[model samples]
Target: MSRPRVQFMRRPGRLMLSAVAAFAVVQLAGCGKQAAPDAETTATLIQPVARLDLKVAKAAPGSRSGEEIYQSVCVSCHGTGVLGAPKTGDAAAWAPRIAQGFDTLTQNAINGIRGMPPRGGGADLTDIEVQRAVAHLANTAGGNFTEPPVGQ
Candidate 1:
């Protein structure tokens, strides 16, 4: 199988890796130049590009992003590929996984997939909440997401 594209943001001109930070993942711009890593920031951030008529667009300050959700819940295993879970920031790892599609992924998280134990192991979080968390990671890892698809 062809190797899945992997994007990594290095120093000034470090080819930006569009993986876990799947921030720009779908586009994967294929840019050879990496933007200077933002200084003094603990993590790459997620800001609203635009929103639909849904209230999800109006999430409060400190309301987590998909990336944040991944970090909080999914990352522990995904970040390291523990228990056969895909590793974060690895497009190859995510490629086949994304092939499983969103609905299935969501259900897997809501219930529990093999190796993964429901919401990556958190049971108390709501389905919607876990959904956002899932999108964050999926998007970061490069999945065309639109839970709040525009123009609703």
Candidate 2:
């Protein structure tokens, strides 16, 4: 008796069917019981990468103190003496300007000097506020300048 010979891939359709069946078996196997993520976990995974809070309280005009004004505006350049600006608390750098007197310094602050914007770049600042900031900055560098009283 002779045995029969069988070839597996003799038909292209059989090969395609075998591949589809194998894929379905794999897909079914992957459907095993798996714990679903909780709401909080899913939310965290899809949450925004960054967030900003811009709700800052602001003081009324002429009410903010000299220190407050410096910290808010003048500090940008004066704090580091950037672009020839005299750094805060540097007596030598402030000596020439201080010698020019308080009025001169106040004027310079109110009307923009080299590298320094008018009112220290604080457009909302009143003249008195500018005066106060100037006195504060000048006094910090060994000058005895007087700042206008608050709310003036």
Candidate 3:
């Protein structure tokens, strides 16, 4: 007498079906409704981390003031006295340069002295603008220098 043989191929198909059903149940379980974000919470999530405020001084058309020029251009080096450049408001560091007089300082700024590039690295700055920036820098460090009039 021959015994009945169990079907091994049908067992694999049933196992695959079971696995697919389990996956679908798990995915459906996570599809439940969630609370919508409130206006303040949404805004906070998307808000900028930092902001910048540029306050430009009022000046004549196409002309920047001594302070304006200094803030924009000369502040990089002179503000911190990088590479022997005199820092703003440092009387001792500026004493020798101030002793050299306004004309000499303006010339150095225009021609580039030592580590400073021509026009304090602002090639777009005009000669008068350079003079104005020089005056602003020198004055901050206890020197009495007049800023050249704009439009010169």
Using TM-score as the measure, which candidate wins? 2
- What does candidate 1's lDDT look like per residue over 1-152, in tens digits? 98765554224345444244576655576867978877645343554566567454434333555665676678789887889888776778777777888887789888897888876776656666666776667776787765532122
Best by lDDT: 2
**TM-scores, in order shown?**
0.52, 0.70, 0.61
Instruction: Give the poorly placed runs of model 3, Cα more than 4 Å off.
Output: 1-62
Winner on lDDT (1 vs 3)? 3
lDDT of 2 by residue, 38-146 (tens): 9998998998999988997778899988999999999999889899999999999999999999999999999999888888789999999999899999999999988
lDDT tens readout by residue for model 3, 1-152: 98776775648888788899999999999998888879998998898899798997655543998898888888999888799888899999899999999999999999999999999998788888888988888998898988888767
Q: Where does candidate 2 have its weakest 10-residue lDDT segment?
A: 3-12
lDDT of each: 0.68, 0.91, 0.87
> Which order, best to worst by lDDT?
2, 3, 1
lDDT of 2: 0.91
Clashes of each: 6, 0, 0
